[model samples]
Target: MPQNRPRRPKVLCLDDEPAVVEGITRTLRKLYDVTGCTKGTEALAVLEADPGFAVVLSDMRMPEMNGAEFLAKARELAPDATRMLLTGQTDLDAAIAAINEGQIFRFLTKPCPPPTLRGAMAAAVAQHRLVTGERVLLQKTLRGSVEVMMEVLGLVSPTYFGRTTRLRHLAADLATALGHPAVWQIEVAAMLSQLGYVVLAPEIAEKVYYGRILDQRERAEVERAWVQAAEMLAPIPRLEPILWIVRNVRRTAADMAHQPGASPDLVRAARILRVAMDFDELLADGRTSAQLAIDTLRGREGHYDEDVLDALEALRGGGQRSRVAEVPVGALAPGMILVEDLALASGMLLVARGYEVTERLLARISGYPADALATDTVRVVLPREQAEAA
Candidate 1:
């Protein structure tokens, strides 16, 4: 007999009768790691505790909760899990409810043969794989492309996006603290929030960075470029949804929360990018420290959403501590993170703080034989192992 694979995707089967549950388990046990439950409540408990079950199969007409209701709960718990309904032949309404409300992938009549049950389970598992695999691809591939673009921008337009290294971390932290599902999108948006600088003149960029009032024409140009960036980025694959959040970033917190064009995830991503951008600008002004900048924003009503404000507060719970040590430029390694802004002899910012030193940056530093860059000591944050070694 062919033995069941230990690493096969797990499937949870729920039915009111022990005999039915046992039969279902026996059928699927060879292909999948099957768990049999006599009640829907037990199945739900398993989903909550483990959440690794790729397919949830529930029988209709259970005493505690119907198949549709149980599957609905399952959907809320594990949206990625494929739901399937097993109903009696006469229960047309039950099957329809499962399909419509529970969003079940397939419904089978009671007394399904061993081969039929096997095929249905195979299809459900395939659906689960498709959804979860797509999510992983988006998170990895899209994030990678966005980071590459930001890295190149950081090299060319340091003053604009250099500060964004810190902003990205802050926004990502806040999104994680609030349990935002599309956290990678929010972080990518934060990093690319200053992308409009690609179009702005260096002087105009400085004016915006320092919070100086721009002339009517300059302000209008900046505004147009800000909206133009989304249009430019929309053509990239998997970036359409991210640009959707980026475009709405100009909207106020109230607009983001209530606007018809913005979905809830979009609203969250918009608020995060908005706060991250404003917070970065506030820090760049050098009027106050990071904590004080957040404090100032907190005092300005209608400027930020309260939940975002709370998330920023949580971020501040760890006060700023300069853990980096000064090292000569030659001592800089590829893995180290810059602790302070690096500027050229002409006072043009070269790289923003919190940027990880890369081989490319190392080569740039080597090319600059000037006294300010080649021989000067720069501050950098070291990883725990490197710090200990030092």
Candidate 2:
């Protein structure tokens, strides 16, 4: 059987005038699927139904919501969609100003020639493909790269490496609660947040993991590690956003509010990472109960954003249940969270509870001579889907 031809990219045109909607739709429908709306609000409804529209063209002047306002909201609704502004002579300046606010991809003056409109739509379609294509690539490749890099870090820095793993899980939970997109970047940043610790003293990693207090000088070293690790990862392709989030993971909420120029995604990822890291520190120390940790986070002014804390609290209220299974070392796989202290015969802590399991970590654990180990069956908290399967 022959495969069906792929559908053409969809375009949305919004204007208060029926004539304008018909004109734009008629001009583009021959080459593309066009959704035309005479009301900006109705267009928003159209967007809500199918956010996959490749291009949004809105007139600069309209009742209630103007082009800029509509496109701004549209940008939030479908960030990957390319936005274009249609402006009259009198509204050109307003449209230009709205460019910054709406993050519009292109603008066309009123009475645009059919040729010019076609070209602009073509360019918008190309831009949409570029943006959405890059996002897909990052989602596929970067996720694997982050996993392997963190797993390799485990070979030399098991304690702090484990903290990064735990933080990733917590960050993911918070992201889901807030309907925040870009969760892949958030999870990757949480894992890489501990990269700085790999260069610090071994004892320092253990201390930080266990929430052991460090003197001023030691604290400075930890801060330095944070900066250094972020710097190292900054040059990698498609990792710039995650690095920014990781570098600012320790910044106060006040600092975040003042950095008006940073990407909202960056701010969001950083805020969640901070709360999760701090919350994990308390858990690792065993000095505070889960409820107490939540309370402490709430009172730490300028530390965790209120919205972030609220999301975390909502997540906590649900009681995150864990599913554990006793499995031999040979059955271990990457990404599992250990529920017990994995130790060698000499009683050295090989790995700690709440640690994210990885292939490299498992390899080392299994490499230990059989005579030096007491038991082969390790208890691990399986991922939800896997637990369900079991």
Candidate 3:
């Protein structure tokens, strides 16, 4: 006999009958690491010592502890393990309790055929692997795509970009705190909410960023970009679902443009993105930092979500600080640092770390008083030590 075969999955079979344990062990030993336990307590101890068991089949009516109680503890100890209940008793309540409390993956009656047992065990193991693999892949793909999209958007239009990033983070945090699954979709929506902007003209982009009241023609043009963007992405198989979400985002925003009452989740995501984008604009437009948030909130009578407004207010008072700086009127220059922590009217940060000074920025700084440098603001080009030490 070969001393060893290929690594096999470990399984724990719990039953009060010695003959059943012997038969199951003899049947499965060739394919699995089978451990037979007569008592639930003994089974638990075995499981505690070696939690690699992929499938745990326990008798429904054990003496000391029932199958439900044992499987419930098993679920906590080895969360990845697939639990199955075996019973000769036809107690519907016990079966329901086993499923509800123990999270049993399968239920089998006593005198199970060897082939049936083998098939069930195999199926449970396969399902466990498939579900775990898909979850891992989904997380990896979602995270990587979101990161790449954010980077691309930042490169395309550095000025008005990153609003969604902030909003997504805030929304995700809030959703997690509330234990809401809808938050996951909201976060994804926030990440790609501005995908339609890529289809907009630079002039239109500028108007949107500057809070310049858009005329009827401009509003219609901007609204059409959402549908255009969805169409552009429809051919890409991987992006189909994302495009669907984007379409809804546009519809929600457009519906709430002149009117109100849309999906609450969409409304919340849109409002957050709207505020975040406007905040970015105010920073670029040299708006007053001190009262920008208050002003923006006041202006959202019919446009923004009131709940999102509350969240933004909480963000200000809470520790959700932005990395932007506020420079005084005089200390502004190309490559000069912004001393004040300027919160854009839309609640976005202005002077983020590593932000480069441009000619337009230099011009804006020159208009300010030379001696009136905002406390702690400086040019970006200064030595790291000097900037920090100052």
Backbone clash count, each prediction separately: 0, 0, 13
The residue pairs that clash in candidate 2, if any, are none
Candidate number achieving the greatest lDDT relative to the actual structure: 2
Q: Is candidate 1 or candidate 2 better by lDDT?
A: 2
lDDT of 3 by residue, 174-202 (tens): 55544343455557766676666767887
Which ten contiguous residues of candidate 1 have the minimum total lDDT?
314-323
Q: What ordering of candidates by TM-score runs from best to worst?
A: 1, 2, 3
- Rank order by lDDT, top first? 2, 1, 3
- Candidate 1 vs candidate 3, lDDT winner: 1
- What TM-score fits each model? 0.88, 0.86, 0.50
The root-mean-square deviation over C-alpha atoms between each candidate and the true structure, in angstroms, is 3.1, 3.1, 10.7
Scored against the true structure, residue 134 in model 2 reaches a CA lDDT of 83
Candidate 2 residues 313-342, lDDT tens each?
A: 777766564577888867778767886667
Q: Which has the greatest TM-score?
A: 1
Error of 3 at 98 (Å): 12
Error of 2 at 220 (Å): 3.1
TM-score, structure 1 vs. true: 0.88
